[model samples]
Target: IDGFGGLRSKTKVITGVSLPASIESIKARLPVWNFDGSSTGQAPGEDSEVILKPQAVFRDPFRGGSNVLVMADCYTPGGEAIPTNTRAGAAALFAQKPEEESASGPRRPSHRAPRRSST
Candidate 1:
């Protein structure tokens, strides 16, 4: 928010405004968050910077064809967003990278004999 716009002392005092025109404009300013939890993978001394990945894009019905709705998922250097309940035995499933297949190569199909009909 530094280079984008100068900071004002008061939140109510909006002497100026700069709005993003397109989706790319908005995307450039995304991944913005307040780092507080430990799941963000940020060290105590490191700067807080949240990361967001774009998932899908849809036309904004309310805003007509000029605007769009961007669906994205928040991710930290460690992983996706953490669940509200951080207790054991909880059924929370976080997003993770897909597993790699075996290095041996792809599996082959099995051969089977054809059956004859008893007319």
Candidate 2:
């Protein structure tokens, strides 16, 4: 104890780094775009979010996918997790992709192969 009821010396350590690629990109882009968090220019209900961008924060940039990061206000009043909304939104977005259909039909043989005069 030094003087005013406080500890004198202490040591701190870093365990891990868990920043996502998307978030890192956002932070990097901040200077280029000059995005200010002013109310007039920002998106609706953006101020209510804790972690504004989840995918951006957790994604790996080197892998190279999902250029845009989506942030959803998915929290409940009771602090309970709501996964249904997020899952549905992702599903809807995924459905937009076009699927290829096969043009070939099933083949059926007219006769059996060379059964030597069984009759």
TM-score of 1: 0.30
* Collision pairs in model 2: 20-57, 23-56
Q: What is the per-residue lDDT of model 1 for residues 1-119, given as tens digits with 9 covering 90 to 100?
A: 12123321111212333444645565554343333333333223353443435444445688664455555444445664523212111213212323643233124455688888888
Best candidate, lDDT: 1
Candidate 2 C-alpha lDDT tens digits along 18-54: 3454465554432111112222222234442222222
Report how far residue 44 has shifted in candidate 1, in Å.
7.5
How far does residue 95 in candidate 2 sit from its true spot (Å)? 4.0
Report the backbone clash tally of model 1. Answer: 0
**C-alpha displacement of 49 in model 2, angstroms?**
6.1
Q: Largest TM-score belongs to which candidate? A: 1
Q: Which residue runs of candidate 1 sit more than 4 Å off their true CA positions? A: 1-47, 78-119
